[model samples]
Target: AQSVAQPEDQVNVAEGNPLTVKCTYSVSGNPYLFWYVQYPNRGLQFLLKYITGDNLVKGSYGFEAEFNKSQTSFHLKKPSALVSDSALYFCAVRITGGFKTIFGAGTRLFVKA
Candidate 1:
């Protein structure tokens, strides 16, 4: 029983535009999606992972993510966005064999300049 749904809690991009942060998931097998970024107090930062092959997966700094396995969606892309890319974004799902990693209650990105 793995689950994640980040139905936008906050998102406002302006610095350079082109930024999307949204995710949805529910898993039983063949699902190990992940994307994380947190700054304020600093803890989570492992942005980008889909576990298998390119469904458009790239990470670190100039992030990217698009692994839509029939609408199980995993969307988090950044083409040009940096006001230090205002932080706090999380969408994760990894409980396949069980070591639990299910998180999505954060989506705060306000990159203004």
Candidate 2:
């Protein structure tokens, strides 16, 4: 079985400070990792993906994630947060032979002005 866990229910940060939303996963075979962002009543937007190769993957809105195979973790990060960056984030994983993607419960990021 493949699954993802976002340990935090919410994260709060100042508009100019850095922010991180942690995520971990479990899978049977080679894992396809993805990060998505969602606004109120809107569909998720693809932030980034880590299929293979580089451990460090960058994405939209100045966001990036590090793929740690040993730890089975992929944590999203940003150098500086913005008020507009406040939204819901979901981490997902996909294994072979399946069209379904497993998503985390989601984490709400609150960037204060």
Top of the candidates by TM-score:
2
What TM-score should be assigned to candidate 1?
A: 0.33
What's the TM for model 2?
0.97
Tens-digit lDDT track for model 1 on 11-96?
99898889999999998788888898989977998977988878999999889999988999999999899999898899998855
Query: Cα miss at 8, model 1 (Å)?
Result: 1.8
Q: How many pairs of residues collide in each model? A: 0, 0
What lDDT does each candidate get? 0.89, 0.96
lDDT digits (tens) for residues 35-105 of candidate 2: 99999999999999999899999999899999999999999999999999999999999986677899999
CA RMSD, predictions in order: 10.7, 0.8
Per-model TM-score, in order, reads 0.33, 0.97
